[model samples]
Target: MDKKGYNTKGRGGGNVNEGGDGDKWSRWWWGLSHRKSAPSEESSNSNQVQRSPSQSKSPKQKIRISSRSDKLPFYYQNWFLVLLTLMSLSCFAFALFVFLYLYPDSIESSPSSTSPASSEVVEITYGTVLKLMHEKTKFRLHSHEVPYGSGSGQQSVTGFPDVEDSNSYWIIRPQPGTSAKQGDPIKSGTIIKLQHMRTRRWLHSHWFSSPISGNQEVSCFGGDSESDTGDLWRLLIEGSGNIWRKDQRIRLQHADTGVYLHSHNKKYSRIAGGQQEVCGVQDKRAENIWLAAEGVYLPVNGSE
Candidate 1:
């Protein structure tokens, strides 16, 4: 019994309160401690339960997130490559458009236009504008203002390799006293005149020798109003038809010199480099054959 009414027991030095209020206080402390200890135990058990699930699932969630994060850059890289390809195609298309807009004739006079097999054959009539291609040498009858360094010293005639040359064009005309008119289909033996489209000169051959072959010199002489017997060339059709056709091969014999218009593989080196010589050959041969090519063939008698 002490002043607080608690017994200080001797066996293990314990304090046992004896009064009713002290007993009540002791019970309250015990109850409070029990309640605190109960809450701590429950909290510890709850924490263990929560930690078990989180720890178990953490590695799976991390794997999924890491996989998505790794693939995200590749997905964006694929989209970037697609956009880059589209932009490159757009730039190429724009460049092609600009090129076509600038040079229209480059498309118009392409190899397709000059191909005889591809073009529609129309009647070659008087006053028709045409290019005569040498069948053997594959050269066009080309004339320029550049005069011959030798021979007659007139405007020189040469076989040009290019299909798109505007100087290769020739306008067909009848002889001075002929009854033939424009748009009339030419007969096989019809004597005609070829006027150079660019220079307005007549295709003429005379007694002078050629620069290369020493055959009769073929030159472009006279102007728009000039007339001469040397300008006449008689058309000799090789095939069965007397009426001239675009697909038929023909020869032009100079009425003055009686030589066929001819070309060969002989290329000039100086003034007209890489160009074959156009001259007059007395004997009818394969090199004299010419075909109508790359021209606006007029329909016979204006019938389209």
Candidate 2:
């Protein structure tokens, strides 16, 4: 009975020892699994931290690209506005230049035919500015500062073809020792003096032979204060009107020489080319007829 009990106890003790060893092996396996799991979790956390920064920077880069694209339209729009402004200014300047070039008469204030003061028929009075036109030759009596090459050697006179020449303008004046005033009416047989408007000279004639016709030399001589009997001219009215009218045909007879102002088809060559010669003739021919043309005539008794 005792041997049987000992065997039973020994078997029981062996069973307890096997149970302790199994417990220790199970604990070791559990610890090894826990350490491996810890390493895997740490690697996963590190990977998440690195990916989070890239993800955060991606949105900022997208925002930067979107901002650049949004500004492009505004930049082009600003340049377009500048170009439009420059084009508009250039067009305005061109238009202003064209306007000034087309209308030059708006600034000119000379005595033209379209002037307001020369639109009506007015009487020829003393101090009246006028142009004398030859009836037969259709030339204007003109004079300049040029001296005659031959004959009287005074201020040369000619018949100008152009009606717009300012040199043809003459101011009618009374004789130096006459009672006639500025606005007085001129009679048919009145003795008058023609004063050049430009040079202030007087129409004069002398006994010297003419250069072309060899009859007499008619020229412009003297000034506002210097005058002689050679500057005098007698008006011979052809029609019946006692008062000299603008439409009346008349003849001028020199007071010094018994000659009339004449012009022919003969033109000058060198000094006054293409201009008709103005001279004096003893005969009262048809070439000596003259009529008053474009002028600033004074009103008769202020009734223009």
Candidate 3:
């Protein structure tokens, strides 16, 4: 159509028909209309007039909205789904209960085996060992040694004995410190008088002494046949195998006298069989040492 002869269907027709422009436009926008030209489709359908391209539109583009998807299923989107669902409610209630009841404690206490608050300690003594069920717990000797003491006077010392014949045995508990777990080794030479920190409470200071009386024949580990010259603070607990006196080493032997700790004065330490120096002295009996030191000095039947 010629620019001037193109049809104008509505009122207000102009002498010039820009709609019939000589320049080519691939398609007419739904809204573009020359003031002197026919109405746009938007004008015809204003009810659906949402987006319309323009002859001179601003840089900003318009948006068009489509429809929604299928609504959520009843089970999934039901407003009261949790309120009436027994299983879901139970789970929810249980979750809420766990969260409310256990979460705080978990955060605060963090129940663990190593926590300081996880364990408690109690003080005890060698006697405490007697209370333990022997069938359930095994006795481990962390350490043992003769009471360190002096004197050849160990006899009938009943004033302090806890048993009828303490020198012969021990009936008290094994002082335990850092109780050994099952299978742990029992240190043979461990000095029971001194307790490790973990077992400090169970170590009774009384274990440091023995109950011996005067009148018992005491021989110094390195003295002559005359008198014993053993350290005033040395005692022996057990020994065997051709034992001899070392200046420092002593032995407890079951001789004609009894279970006695052979001892000598500090000066006569480590004597031998030769009568010239004669120092292989045996205490002969527990009642031979007077003031015992740092040992559960058995009277004569106090312990094993």
Question: What C-alpha RMSD separates each model from the true structure?
Answer: 7.1, 12.3, 21.8
Compute the lDDT of residue 237 as modeled in candidate 3. 25
lDDT of 1 at 246: 88
Clashing pairs in 2: none
User: What do the candidate models score in CA lDDT, each in turn?
Assistant: 0.89, 0.85, 0.28
lDDT of 3: 0.28
User: Candidate 2 lDDT, tens digit per residue, 205-229?
Assistant: 9988777777688899999889999
User: What residue runs in model 1 are displaced by over 4 Å at the alpha carbon?
Assistant: 1-84, 108-119, 302-304
Q: Tell me the tens digit of each residue's lDDT in model 1 across 119-155.
A: 5556789988889999998999999999998878999
- C-alpha lDDT of residue 35 in model 2: 96
Task: Sort the candidates on lDDT, descending order.
Answer: 1, 2, 3
- The per-residue C-alpha lDDT of model 2 at residue 38 equals 93
Residue-wise lDDT of candidate 3 within 1-304, one digit each (tens)? 4579855543456443565443325234422445324455546666345334452243333222211123455655665765577778788889988897866654543323112221322222232221111111111112112222444322111111121211222222222344633222123232222222222211121111331322233221221222121212222423442211111122223223333332222221222111111112233443233211122211222222
> Once superposed on the true structure, which residue ranges of model 2 sit more than 4 Å away at CA?
1-121, 302-304
